[model samples]
Target chain A: MIEVRHLVKKYGNHTAVSDLSFDIDGGQVYGFLGPNGAGKSTTMNIITGCLAATSGEVRIGGYDIFEQPEKAKKLVGYLPEHPPLYLDMTAEEYLKFVAEAKGVKRSDMKRQIEYVIEVTRLQEMYKRQTKFLSKGYRQRVGVAQALLGEPELIILDEPTVGLDPRQIIEIRDLIKQLGKTHTVVLSSHILSEIRSVCTSAIIIAKGKMIANDTLENLENIYSGDSYVTLRVKASEIEIRRALAPMDAVMGVECTQLQDGVTEAKIDIDSDFRDKVPEQLFYAFASIDRPILHLAEEHATLEDVFLELTSQADISEESADDTEAKDGETV
Target chain B: MTAIFKRELSSYFKGFTGYVYIAFVLFFIGTYSATLNVRGTYPSFEYAIGNMSFIYIIVIPILTMRVFADEKRQKTDQLLYALPVSMGQVVVGKMLAVAVVMVVPAIVSCIYPPILGKFGSVNYASAYGSIIAFFFMGVALASIGVFLSTLTDSQAMSAGMCFLVLLVNYFQTTLVGFLPTSALASFLAITVVILILAVIVWYMTKNLLAAAIFAVVIGGANFIYYSVRPVKYGGLFPDIIGKLSMFSRFDTFIESAFDLTAILYYLTVTALFMFFTVQSLEKRRWS
Candidate 1:
């Protein structure tokens, strides 16, 4: 377990992280979701002891990070935004050196190194110098280094960046596998990546955590009213008149459709599907109109993410970002 | 500590810096030995060591510049910081590694006195004494270089700044004579020195109030001392500066005095700078 209480990191006049606190339990993968410069890396650095916190304490497996750093650090492994690697040394040699520095026993060292190499699939590149390796392989070596000593907690910062789609899937699978045995905490700006891998997520905008919950719970929390999309072989006025008469219906509006069939969206509270669909069916039948399509449009995770993160003063710098995400969510 | 020490030592030989540093030091040693001991027919190797002591001002920077600076520039210090080792252990390990690199060539230099004994009578005791003193003196100088390397991440800048400091320490005795040693002049000099120290303290702690209090206290104490005993300040500043010269202290061992005070001074410098190196590293994490 890792507990970060009121963590803060400041650089001169700029605040990197402010009054952030969260607890991470074991055996689950947690995602840190934020845009660029959102203090994800800073918080990870502080938790892993790479950077000192301005105020507050981090306890890893009940060991205070500042007071008993070696004990606390022994329980955690960290990979920063850039893999801290020695280009001059081969991957095998670097892993051995790190294993020794991490206080792995000489007897277990060989076995530990082999395990990480196999897990990261670096068996082919073990003898090659890190400088000659591709960026993806270098990142794998970085992950391999963190896996050494078998720390209880592994923290990765943007682990899938700069990788091809196939490599990204491979790493995502690896992270999911690691989560079954060890707690995994990863940060990325990719929403789908988090949705695919993370059991829970914490989303931050401008250094403040805006949401922290499961994807399903977050979708429900932001979803205020239910809307349904219905397609009927009827005129727009006919469909609107049928939906507007239902007692549970708040309003109805006709939206564009590709087929000759007309489409209208119905807004209502609770699950009025049973009564409303029957009422609409009878009303439309009496008017001799055929129903082609009827389905409830459930809110997606992207909708909740946009509605929450876009409320702050997004600058001209991020206007394009908003537009791009808006297109996908809509 | 052992892991870091082994890595540092291996890195020295992995690059040309270690071999070049040893070759440069030995080259100067060979030239100085021929001129002072062989051609001059001096029985004591101490004379040769004394004449060649200035070589450290150049070689020490080359040997120690990349020790911490390269780690920082490459961002490998993050690995060190994240490791389960204390900052003190890392500093001590690197210092010991550099000491090994320096002592290796000095060991080869150790065989010179016995070989010279074949041609003529040689003072073996004094030769060994000076060799030991030379080793400690170089260690002390290298510690200063290591501390300077911790202050910046640019290797060239670290080397340049370390070389400048060594130059000042080498010529401090001569430079001291140029300073006026009158009561008022000594008072002003001490005040300026104390204020500079306070500023450095402030830079380290970033506590302006504490630094201001310390400066006032030191300035007030010095002023009271000068007012009470005006004549005692005469020639004191120059005498103090001469005492602080790192190489000047080694002169006693070369003269065959076996001065334990100089040896103590060298050890003190080594300890003080090692402590400062640790502090510099710790401060980097906080800031």
Candidate 2:
């Protein structure tokens, strides 16, 4: 439903979004996962035709956003990071304006507005001025505005930033419901929100795409490297000595927790991660050290997000190194 | 476009801007019409409109300051940009809305000439002609104000800048008379104006090389023209400034010449500034 190719957006000397490319299919809730200043908003802006890419092509529903903006924009609804609400206007009036601006038929405008208001649960606040609405209600108004015209795709940028936990969940559930019928793309810095609500995730950092996959695939791919934390009734040296001879143990660090208890963090090789727990069990048994705690720590999406974004920085640094080397050669 | 026009128009009436602007303009119209036409027994209604032309310097700013600036400040410009409408449509719709708000007072003032005719002989042609000219000039000034509003996000800044621009245009003719009218003075003045234009270009495009090249080329060309024909530069600055003054063009109608060129000039300016406003909005997407 959406294709962003070689998109680059630069503000003077600083590139906000760099040569990023992605394709999103219809009817899936896609999460744009990135840290702050990671160009997620810039990419979203470009996709929704709210911004111009320095040099790139964006297409929505087979229509070029720049060349056929009206047609392309008709197929997409966008709620920017800041909910674009006129404080003086009532929610109903704002939605009416959006509906008209979207070219909703006069006959269907009322029904469409009411449907979105109902879905976003903004029926009661419909008569209130947007300024009087709280941040969460204002956000719902923004969402309702996007939901007008029944666009095929909805793009939201950090939709739940300031909302309380319950409001966030409501918005997420609303987005999930939207995903059943429409293509949804939401950008967020909060990992848990994306993991809970999004089916597919695209991770970007430093204006580059670091990872893109289904949530399950990303978890499975990142779950290969696991850590095992152990609390044993032995001295630090004995705990270390027990695991030192094991080749499957990539690295281990032990700390003395008390007179006879020691806490150890063991990094197991991917090939032996499943069996390493059993291996540690026998190793500690042979050493006459009683095992108090032994649990495998699986890598969650949060860990994957951190690893990928940080890896982006390391790769960027290496790229800088190569450029410096070339400069030195010249 | 109609949706935006209606929304903007209703907002003007709902808020203080529309009522205040209409009252302000009509108050002056009433005061001027009473003094110039009714009290002074002047037969011509154009004189009142001509006298009241200065109100635009204050009223246009108030009417147009929040049109685009408030949208940007509130971040509602994103909705406008993301909407299915083109920036041109949005801009024209807004300009039309302000024009409609301005027309309310113009329509009220339209009742003045025939009423003034009750007391004495009134040249209805010149009277209505100047009213038309006043409306055109006000719309033209409103367009310029809208363009200025797009240059900033703060309503205060937009209003201040708009007032400054209209004030300069309001007194442009008088300011030109202060110039020495010498070829050297004209050359220096034109260069300064070109430099300012170039700076604006740089500020918008953020391209230093382009601004420098533009400044040098325009400056060099102006110097070449001056050096080639020094006599042509004599009083040239003042003439250009006088022609550019929006208020000065209204005087021709008041003087009883229904100048088609002045009406065309107002329309051309209106179109030009509305086009610039659209470009300014589009440019933000790139920036």
Q: Global lDDT of each model?
A: 0.88, 0.91
TM-score of each: 0.89, 0.88
The fraction of correct interface contacts reproduced by each prediction comes to: 0.75, 0.93
As a whole number from 0 to 100, the lDDT of residue B195 in candidate 1 is 96
DockQ of each: 0.66, 0.76
Report backbone clashes per prediction: 0, 0
Q: For candidate 2, write residues B19-104 as lDDT tens digits.
A: 99989999998999889877898978889889988999988898899999999999999999999999999988998889888888
lDDT of 2 at B80: 93
* RMSD score of candidate 2 (Å): 4.3
lDDT of 2 at A27: 82
- Where is the poorest 10-residue window by lDDT in model 1 chain B? B252-261
C-alpha positional error of residue B137 in candidate 1 after TM-score superposition, expressed in Å: 1.5
